[model samples]
Target: MESNQTNRALIKATVIALSVAVVTLVLFILPAEYDIDPTGVGKKLGLTVFNQDGESPSAKTSTDGDQDTVVVTVPAGKGIEYKLSMMESQQVTYEWQTSNGELYVDLHGEPDGDNTGYFKSYTVATVESMKGSFVVPFNGSHGWYWKNNTDKDIDVQLIFSGEYIVEGLK
Candidate 1:
């Protein structure tokens, strides 16, 4: 009967819609937003490394006398970014210097769960060395973007003492 065919079509459409929704959640949203990858599809797609929720899986809070030093290498005409996780009101003292030449840098922070492209820039310029202290304004991630402008690779030595979480630089 025509009535029976209509009912079957409606049911089929509903099932298809639900299936697409679940696939989208599992393949994209879960991994990008929460680092959850039950089906491993997100990992295969390289989506699990990003956290749109403002919390990185590599992020950790530490209170002990923590100090770290890192050497970052940037190829010529290339750039890199690194960040430290901090709660509101946390502070850190930082210093960095380039072994070769002056480079462009931007020091900034992005608040947790911010989806409106909101960010705060503390410093932006070309500098060979810098030393300063930062006081976190919100629960978020703060760090630097460095660009190598010269025709040769550059080595940057960065040191920080703080009670925050930092990810390993690549």
Candidate 2:
């Protein structure tokens, strides 16, 4: 009876350990779901309309493209975390993918004494899937710069992986 009880206890321990291992691997494995410090993002990330969905994305779309600016308005909280993809050699080798569709980002103008203007600058990248592959140190670059290269205006839906901390507008 004692030996049977011992075996049962060992089985229970093994089961518990395996369960924990599986959960941890799922959470930390590469290409895992997005994760960020909720406290920081909750405090900072919010939505700002860069442009109405389904429009051409171009540098010209920005109202203040003339001036370069990094328009991060929201203050990041003390504890913020985001799940970023591990840097890969293949990712760096890609042609920066501007052909299919592009989001032209332009620099922003200087404001008060703050150097927010430095953050200004537009970026253009092709939009193949709605995903908009990003290499952000953050979960994602939420906002986008759009261009209406087409004669008629088109609606473009944009989705970013993580929270959008601030909104910058022209």
Candidate 3:
């Protein structure tokens, strides 16, 4: 009879441990690491910054500022935008270059509250590479729009440092 009681207690303890592990994984681990927040808690906690490619849109914080390097792919005859969030008077220095050909590029900013389809263009041109620094005039998102007018896809490598948060590819 004592042996039977001992076996039952051990079995109960094992089951309890497994149950706690599963709950923790479903609630915290999956969302924080893999961006698989089934309960939407990870996004609310600002933890789901990684895309499918395992690249995070959030910048790496440093003593001087935030910095990041991102590679964006523009499909043939398509366009894409990479943006960063910044406050008024914040500054950033950036450089981007294409792998092969020139792209129609637009460096611009959109204000934080005006939603009348308005954006302020700082520069527009077709180029293979560009390097510049910008001080935002208002609290808003600032970045580049690259349009590839070719038959093959092109990759653009962008490196930037600033006091900003990356908004990712749009």
Query: Please, what is the whole-model Cα lDDT of each candidate in the order they appear?
Result: 0.81, 0.31, 0.83
Task: List residue ranges in candidate 2 displaced over 4 A.
Answer: 1-116, 120-123, 126-142, 166-170
On lDDT, the stronger of 1 and 2 is 1
Q: TM-scores of all models? A: 0.63, 0.26, 0.66
> Which ten-residue region of model 3 has the weakest summed lDDT?
46-55
Clashing pairs in 3: none
Regarding TM-score, does 2 or 3 come out ahead?
Answer: 3
What are the C-alpha RMSDs, in order, of all predicted structures? Answer: 6.5, 17.8, 12.2
Q: Estimate the TM-score for candidate 2.
A: 0.26
How many steric clashes between backbone atoms does each model show? 0, 31, 0
Q: What lDDT is reached at residue 46 by model 2?
A: 32
- Output the TM-score of candidate 1: 0.63
For model 2, what is the C-alpha lDDT against the true structure?
0.31
Evaluated with lDDT, which candidate comes out highest? 3
Q: After superposition, how far is residue 125 of candidate 3 from its true place, in Å?
A: 0.7
